[model samples]
Target: MIKVMDRLLLFVYSLAVGAASVFAIVMAAGGFDADWLKNAVDDIIGEDALVQTLVIAIGVVLLLLSLRIFIVSFKRSGGQAPSINQRTEHGDIRISVDTVENLALKAASRTRGVKDLKARVRAADSGLQIMIRAFVDGDTPIPALSEEMQKTVSELVQETTGIPVSEVSVYIANVTQAPTTYKSRVE
Candidate 1:
Protein backbone atom coordinates (compact mmCIF):
# COMPACT_ATOMS: atom_id res chain seq x y z
CA MET A 1 0.00 0.00 0.00
CA ILE A 2 2.77 2.43 0.89
CA LYS A 3 4.66 1.45 -2.25
CA VAL A 4 1.62 2.09 -4.40
CA MET A 5 1.13 5.48 -2.79
CA ASP A 6 4.77 6.35 -3.28
CA ARG A 7 4.64 5.48 -6.97
CA LEU A 8 1.50 7.51 -7.43
CA LEU A 9 3.09 10.49 -5.69
CA LEU A 10 6.17 10.17 -7.91
CA PHE A 11 4.02 10.07 -11.02
CA VAL A 12 2.15 13.17 -9.94
CA TYR A 13 5.40 15.01 -9.21
CA SER A 14 6.89 14.03 -12.55
CA LEU A 15 3.80 15.20 -14.40
CA ALA A 16 3.81 18.52 -12.57
CA VAL A 17 7.49 19.11 -13.31
CA GLY A 18 7.06 18.20 -16.97
CA ALA A 19 4.10 20.48 -17.34
CA ALA A 20 5.93 23.37 -15.65
CA SER A 21 8.96 22.91 -17.89
CA VAL A 22 6.86 22.95 -21.04
CA PHE A 23 4.96 25.98 -19.86
CA ALA A 24 8.18 27.92 -19.16
CA ILE A 25 9.72 26.90 -22.47
CA VAL A 26 6.67 27.87 -24.45
CA MET A 27 6.32 31.20 -22.70
CA ALA A 28 9.97 31.99 -23.27
CA ALA A 29 9.57 31.14 -26.95
CA GLY A 30 6.87 33.85 -27.39
CA GLY A 31 3.88 31.61 -26.67
CA PHE A 32 2.21 34.61 -25.01
CA ASP A 33 1.81 36.15 -28.45
CA ALA A 34 -0.73 33.46 -29.29
CA ASP A 35 -4.28 34.66 -28.74
CA TRP A 36 -5.31 31.69 -26.57
CA LEU A 37 -2.29 31.93 -24.29
CA LYS A 38 -2.60 35.75 -23.98
CA ASN A 39 -6.31 35.51 -23.17
CA ALA A 40 -5.80 32.79 -20.55
CA VAL A 41 -3.00 34.70 -18.82
CA ASP A 42 -5.03 37.93 -18.87
CA ASP A 43 -8.03 36.25 -17.35
CA ILE A 44 -5.99 34.80 -14.47
CA ILE A 45 -4.28 38.10 -13.72
CA GLY A 46 -7.21 40.38 -14.54
CA GLU A 47 -8.05 41.48 -10.98
CA ASP A 48 -11.16 39.33 -10.63
CA ALA A 49 -10.79 38.65 -6.87
CA LEU A 50 -12.16 35.09 -6.91
CA VAL A 51 -9.95 33.77 -9.73
CA GLN A 52 -6.78 35.14 -8.12
CA THR A 53 -7.71 33.72 -4.76
CA LEU A 54 -8.41 30.29 -6.28
CA VAL A 55 -5.09 30.21 -8.15
CA ILE A 56 -3.17 31.18 -4.99
CA ALA A 57 -4.91 28.45 -2.97
CA ILE A 58 -4.13 25.80 -5.59
CA GLY A 59 -0.49 26.86 -5.84
CA VAL A 60 -0.04 26.69 -2.06
CA VAL A 61 -1.56 23.20 -1.92
CA LEU A 62 0.68 21.94 -4.71
CA LEU A 63 3.76 23.42 -3.03
CA LEU A 64 2.92 21.73 0.26
CA LEU A 65 2.32 18.37 -1.42
CA SER A 66 5.61 18.59 -3.32
CA LEU A 67 7.51 19.37 -0.11
CA ARG A 68 5.89 16.38 1.63
CA ILE A 69 6.77 14.05 -1.23
CA PHE A 70 10.39 15.23 -1.22
CA ILE A 71 10.73 14.64 2.52
CA VAL A 72 9.16 11.17 2.37
CA SER A 73 11.44 10.06 -0.48
CA PHE A 74 14.51 11.35 1.37
CA LYS A 75 13.78 9.23 4.47
CA ARG A 76 12.18 6.23 2.79
CA SER A 77 14.48 3.35 3.72
CA GLY A 78 16.27 4.42 6.91
CA GLY A 79 15.57 1.24 8.83
CA GLN A 80 18.14 -0.56 11.00
CA ALA A 81 18.47 -4.29 11.62
CA PRO A 82 16.32 -5.50 14.51
CA SER A 83 17.77 -6.33 17.93
CA ILE A 84 16.98 -9.26 20.22
CA ASN A 85 15.46 -8.44 23.59
CA GLN A 86 15.70 -10.67 26.66
CA ARG A 87 14.32 -10.29 30.13
CA THR A 88 16.80 -10.94 32.98
CA GLU A 89 16.28 -10.92 36.73
CA HIS A 90 18.22 -7.73 37.25
CA GLY A 91 17.58 -6.00 33.93
CA ASP A 92 16.89 -6.51 30.23
CA ILE A 93 19.43 -7.72 27.71
CA ARG A 94 19.74 -6.75 24.05
CA ILE A 95 21.73 -8.47 21.35
CA SER A 96 22.45 -6.69 18.08
CA VAL A 97 21.92 -8.17 14.67
CA ASP A 98 25.65 -7.85 13.97
CA THR A 99 26.43 -10.30 16.75
CA VAL A 100 24.05 -12.85 15.29
CA GLU A 101 25.56 -12.39 11.86
CA ASN A 102 29.07 -12.92 13.24
CA LEU A 103 27.95 -16.09 15.01
CA ALA A 104 26.42 -17.38 11.76
CA LEU A 105 29.63 -16.61 9.83
CA LYS A 106 31.70 -18.41 12.43
CA ALA A 107 29.53 -21.50 12.27
CA ALA A 108 29.46 -21.59 8.50
CA SER A 109 33.25 -21.14 8.30
CA ARG A 110 33.69 -24.26 10.42
CA THR A 111 31.67 -26.34 7.95
CA ARG A 112 33.95 -28.50 5.81
CA GLY A 113 32.78 -27.60 2.34
CA VAL A 114 32.16 -23.88 2.78
CA LYS A 115 34.84 -21.73 1.06
CA ASP A 116 33.33 -18.27 1.51
CA LEU A 117 30.30 -17.13 3.51
CA LYS A 118 28.18 -14.08 4.03
CA ALA A 119 25.46 -13.92 6.65
CA ARG A 120 22.62 -11.53 7.27
CA VAL A 121 20.39 -11.53 10.37
CA ARG A 122 16.91 -10.19 10.51
CA ALA A 123 14.11 -10.29 13.07
CA ALA A 124 11.25 -12.71 12.58
CA ASP A 125 8.01 -13.53 14.35
CA SER A 126 9.53 -16.43 16.33
CA GLY A 127 12.97 -14.89 16.84
CA LEU A 128 15.68 -14.30 14.25
CA GLN A 129 16.17 -15.39 10.64
CA ILE A 130 19.70 -15.99 9.41
CA MET A 131 20.43 -15.94 5.71
CA ILE A 132 23.74 -17.37 4.59
CA ARG A 133 25.17 -17.13 1.11
CA ALA A 134 28.19 -19.33 0.51
CA PHE A 135 30.66 -20.39 -2.10
CA VAL A 136 32.02 -23.91 -1.88
CA ASP A 137 34.38 -26.28 -3.68
CA GLY A 138 33.00 -27.52 -6.98
CA ASP A 139 33.24 -31.15 -5.87
CA THR A 140 31.19 -30.58 -2.70
CA PRO A 141 27.66 -31.98 -2.56
CA ILE A 142 25.56 -28.82 -2.50
CA PRO A 143 22.39 -30.21 -0.97
CA ALA A 144 24.11 -31.90 1.94
CA LEU A 145 26.53 -29.04 2.49
CA SER A 146 23.70 -26.50 2.55
CA GLU A 147 21.76 -28.57 5.05
CA GLU A 148 24.75 -28.93 7.29
CA MET A 149 25.46 -25.22 7.05
CA GLN A 150 21.88 -24.43 7.98
CA LYS A 151 21.95 -26.71 11.00
CA THR A 152 25.32 -25.54 12.16
CA VAL A 153 24.48 -21.85 11.84
CA SER A 154 21.12 -22.23 13.57
CA GLU A 155 22.43 -24.26 16.48
CA LEU A 156 25.47 -22.08 16.99
CA VAL A 157 23.47 -18.85 16.98
CA GLN A 158 20.88 -20.24 19.37
CA GLU A 159 23.46 -21.74 21.73
CA THR A 160 25.68 -18.68 21.77
CA THR A 161 23.01 -16.01 22.14
CA GLY A 162 20.30 -17.95 23.99
CA ILE A 163 17.88 -16.55 21.41
CA PRO A 164 15.67 -18.72 19.25
CA VAL A 165 16.34 -18.84 15.54
CA SER A 166 13.26 -19.31 13.42
CA GLU A 167 15.07 -20.23 10.27
CA VAL A 168 18.54 -20.49 8.76
CA SER A 169 18.29 -20.24 4.97
CA VAL A 170 21.45 -21.24 3.09
CA TYR A 171 22.03 -20.13 -0.47
CA ILE A 172 24.91 -21.65 -2.40
CA ALA A 173 25.98 -18.73 -4.52
CA ASN A 174 28.84 -20.32 -6.38
CA VAL A 175 31.17 -23.33 -6.61
CA THR A 176 34.84 -22.45 -6.70
CA GLN A 177 37.33 -24.35 -8.84
CA ALA A 178 40.61 -25.47 -7.27
CA PRO A 179 43.57 -23.45 -8.41
CA THR A 180 45.98 -25.29 -10.70
CA THR A 181 49.64 -25.42 -9.74
CA TYR A 182 52.30 -25.05 -12.47
CA LYS A 183 55.52 -27.12 -12.30
CA SER A 184 58.71 -25.17 -13.08
CA ARG A 185 61.09 -26.72 -15.66
CA VAL A 186 64.82 -25.99 -15.60
CA GLU A 187 66.63 -26.50 -18.90
Candidate 2:
Protein backbone atom coordinates (compact mmCIF):
# COMPACT_ATOMS: atom_id res chain seq x y z
CA MET A 1 0.00 0.00 0.00
CA ILE A 2 2.74 2.45 0.99
CA LYS A 3 4.76 1.57 -2.11
CA VAL A 4 1.74 2.18 -4.32
CA MET A 5 1.12 5.55 -2.69
CA ASP A 6 4.77 6.53 -3.14
CA ARG A 7 4.72 5.58 -6.83
CA LEU A 8 1.50 7.48 -7.36
CA LEU A 9 2.98 10.58 -5.71
CA LEU A 10 6.10 10.26 -7.88
CA PHE A 11 3.99 10.01 -11.02
CA VAL A 12 2.03 13.12 -10.12
CA TYR A 13 5.26 15.03 -9.43
CA SER A 14 6.71 13.97 -12.78
CA LEU A 15 3.58 15.11 -14.62
CA ALA A 16 3.62 18.45 -12.82
CA VAL A 17 7.30 18.97 -13.66
CA GLY A 18 6.64 18.15 -17.33
CA ALA A 19 3.76 20.61 -17.48
CA ALA A 20 5.84 23.34 -15.82
CA SER A 21 8.73 22.74 -18.21
CA VAL A 22 6.39 23.08 -21.18
CA PHE A 23 4.96 26.30 -19.75
CA ALA A 24 8.49 27.70 -19.23
CA ILE A 25 9.41 26.87 -22.85
CA VAL A 26 6.29 28.55 -24.17
CA MET A 27 6.86 31.62 -21.99
CA ALA A 28 10.47 31.92 -23.14
CA ALA A 29 9.97 31.28 -26.86
CA GLY A 30 6.91 33.55 -27.27
CA GLY A 31 8.19 36.36 -25.03
CA PHE A 32 5.40 38.51 -23.54
CA ASP A 33 3.70 39.46 -26.84
CA ALA A 34 2.19 36.04 -27.68
CA ASP A 35 -1.55 36.53 -27.01
CA TRP A 36 -2.40 32.85 -27.55
CA LEU A 37 0.32 31.63 -25.18
CA LYS A 38 -0.72 34.18 -22.56
CA ASN A 39 -4.40 33.22 -22.69
CA ALA A 40 -3.64 29.48 -22.68
CA VAL A 41 -1.36 29.77 -19.66
CA ASP A 42 -3.77 32.08 -17.87
CA ASP A 43 -6.70 29.79 -18.56
CA ILE A 44 -4.80 26.92 -17.02
CA ILE A 45 -3.47 28.84 -14.00
CA GLY A 46 -6.40 31.27 -13.47
CA GLU A 47 -6.07 34.93 -12.34
CA ASP A 48 -4.92 34.55 -8.71
CA ALA A 49 -1.16 34.37 -9.53
CA LEU A 50 -1.65 30.60 -9.40
CA VAL A 51 1.62 29.66 -11.08
CA GLN A 52 3.82 31.43 -8.52
CA THR A 53 1.81 31.26 -5.28
CA LEU A 54 0.20 27.81 -5.66
CA VAL A 55 3.49 26.19 -6.73
CA ILE A 56 5.33 27.70 -3.74
CA ALA A 57 2.61 26.57 -1.31
CA ILE A 58 2.54 23.04 -2.68
CA GLY A 59 6.34 22.80 -2.54
CA VAL A 60 6.41 23.96 1.08
CA VAL A 61 3.69 21.48 2.10
CA LEU A 62 5.44 18.56 0.40
CA LEU A 63 8.78 19.50 1.98
CA LEU A 64 7.27 19.62 5.46
CA LEU A 65 5.44 16.31 4.97
CA SER A 66 8.63 14.56 3.85
CA LEU A 67 10.62 15.97 6.77
CA ARG A 68 8.01 14.81 9.29
CA ILE A 69 8.09 11.29 7.83
CA PHE A 70 11.88 11.20 7.98
CA ILE A 71 11.95 12.24 11.61
CA VAL A 72 9.35 9.62 12.65
CA SER A 73 11.23 6.83 10.86
CA PHE A 74 14.48 7.77 12.57
CA LYS A 75 12.92 7.56 16.05
CA ARG A 76 13.54 4.31 18.00
CA SER A 77 10.99 1.53 17.55
CA GLY A 78 10.23 0.32 21.12
CA GLY A 79 7.57 2.27 23.04
CA GLN A 80 8.40 1.10 26.57
CA ALA A 81 8.91 3.54 29.41
CA PRO A 82 10.76 3.10 32.70
CA SER A 83 8.85 2.29 35.89
CA ILE A 84 8.05 5.10 38.33
CA ASN A 85 10.53 3.55 40.76
CA GLN A 86 13.17 3.66 38.04
CA ARG A 87 13.50 7.42 37.98
CA THR A 88 16.98 8.69 38.77
CA GLU A 89 18.05 12.23 39.57
CA HIS A 90 21.73 11.33 39.89
CA GLY A 91 22.88 14.85 39.12
CA ASP A 92 22.83 16.30 35.54
CA ILE A 93 22.87 12.87 33.83
CA ARG A 94 19.75 12.20 31.75
CA ILE A 95 18.83 8.84 30.21
CA SER A 96 15.87 7.60 28.20
CA VAL A 97 14.33 4.13 28.15
CA ASP A 98 14.98 3.76 24.44
CA THR A 99 18.70 4.39 24.97
CA VAL A 100 18.80 1.71 27.66
CA GLU A 101 17.16 -0.87 25.42
CA ASN A 102 19.60 -0.09 22.61
CA LEU A 103 22.60 -0.66 24.88
CA ALA A 104 21.16 -3.87 26.36
CA LEU A 105 20.56 -5.29 22.88
CA LYS A 106 24.13 -4.46 21.92
CA ALA A 107 25.45 -6.22 25.00
CA ALA A 108 23.24 -9.30 24.56
CA SER A 109 24.48 -9.76 21.00
CA ARG A 110 28.06 -10.14 22.32
CA THR A 111 27.24 -13.40 24.10
CA ARG A 112 28.41 -16.70 22.57
CA GLY A 113 25.82 -19.02 20.96
CA VAL A 114 23.50 -16.05 20.53
CA LYS A 115 22.63 -15.11 16.96
CA ASP A 116 20.67 -11.88 17.59
CA LEU A 117 18.90 -9.95 20.36
CA LYS A 118 15.68 -7.95 20.40
CA ALA A 119 14.77 -6.49 23.77
CA ARG A 120 11.52 -5.08 25.09
CA VAL A 121 10.53 -3.64 28.45
CA ARG A 122 7.32 -3.46 30.52
CA ALA A 123 6.66 -1.21 33.44
CA ALA A 124 5.53 -2.97 36.66
CA ASP A 125 4.68 -1.80 40.15
CA SER A 126 7.87 -3.40 41.51
CA GLY A 127 10.24 -2.41 38.76
CA LEU A 128 10.88 -2.71 35.01
CA GLN A 129 10.60 -6.15 33.42
CA ILE A 130 12.66 -7.01 30.37
CA MET A 131 12.05 -9.51 27.62
CA ILE A 132 14.93 -10.49 25.36
CA ARG A 133 14.23 -12.70 22.36
CA ALA A 134 17.39 -14.47 21.25
CA PHE A 135 18.01 -16.58 18.19
CA VAL A 136 20.52 -19.22 19.19
CA ASP A 137 21.97 -22.65 18.36
CA GLY A 138 19.23 -25.30 18.48
CA ASP A 139 21.64 -27.98 19.60
CA THR A 140 22.17 -26.18 22.92
CA PRO A 141 20.18 -27.18 26.00
CA ILE A 142 17.14 -24.98 26.35
CA PRO A 143 17.14 -24.79 30.15
CA ALA A 144 20.81 -23.89 30.59
CA LEU A 145 20.87 -21.59 27.58
CA SER A 146 17.77 -19.71 28.74
CA GLU A 147 19.23 -19.25 32.22
CA GLU A 148 22.53 -17.95 30.88
CA MET A 149 20.80 -15.59 28.46
CA GLN A 150 18.53 -14.23 31.17
CA LYS A 151 21.38 -13.65 33.57
CA THR A 152 23.60 -11.99 30.99
CA VAL A 153 20.87 -9.71 29.70
CA SER A 154 19.83 -8.67 33.19
CA GLU A 155 23.41 -7.86 34.26
CA LEU A 156 24.09 -5.99 31.05
CA VAL A 157 20.95 -3.89 31.35
CA GLN A 158 21.59 -3.08 34.99
CA GLU A 159 25.23 -2.21 34.45
CA THR A 160 24.63 -0.15 31.35
CA THR A 161 21.26 1.51 31.92
CA GLY A 162 21.10 1.56 35.74
CA ILE A 163 17.63 0.04 35.57
CA PRO A 164 16.64 -2.69 38.00
CA VAL A 165 15.52 -5.72 36.08
CA SER A 166 12.88 -7.67 38.01
CA GLU A 167 12.54 -10.18 35.26
CA VAL A 168 14.57 -11.09 32.16
CA SER A 169 12.53 -13.37 29.92
CA VAL A 170 14.21 -14.98 26.95
CA TYR A 171 12.32 -16.35 24.00
CA ILE A 172 14.12 -18.42 21.37
CA ALA A 173 12.38 -17.48 18.16
CA ASN A 174 14.31 -19.61 15.64
CA VAL A 175 17.45 -21.64 15.16
CA THR A 176 19.14 -21.26 11.80
CA GLN A 177 20.91 -24.15 10.05
CA ALA A 178 23.60 -24.06 7.38
CA PRO A 179 22.28 -23.86 3.85
CA THR A 180 22.72 -26.92 1.61
CA THR A 181 23.03 -26.71 -2.16
CA TYR A 182 22.32 -29.62 -4.53
CA LYS A 183 24.79 -30.38 -7.32
CA SER A 184 24.07 -32.41 -10.40
CA ARG A 185 26.35 -33.82 -13.09
CA VAL A 186 25.29 -33.61 -16.72
CA GLU A 187 25.59 -36.88 -18.61
Highest lDDT scorer: 1
Per-candidate TM vs. native? 0.74, 0.47
TM-score of 1: 0.74
- After superposition, which runs of candidate 2 have C-alpha atoms over 4 Å from their true positions? 1-93, 181-187
lDDT of 1 by residue, 48-156 (tens): 8888898888788678769878788688585765678888899998898888899999999988978988999988779888999999996768888888888998899
RMSD of 1: 3.7
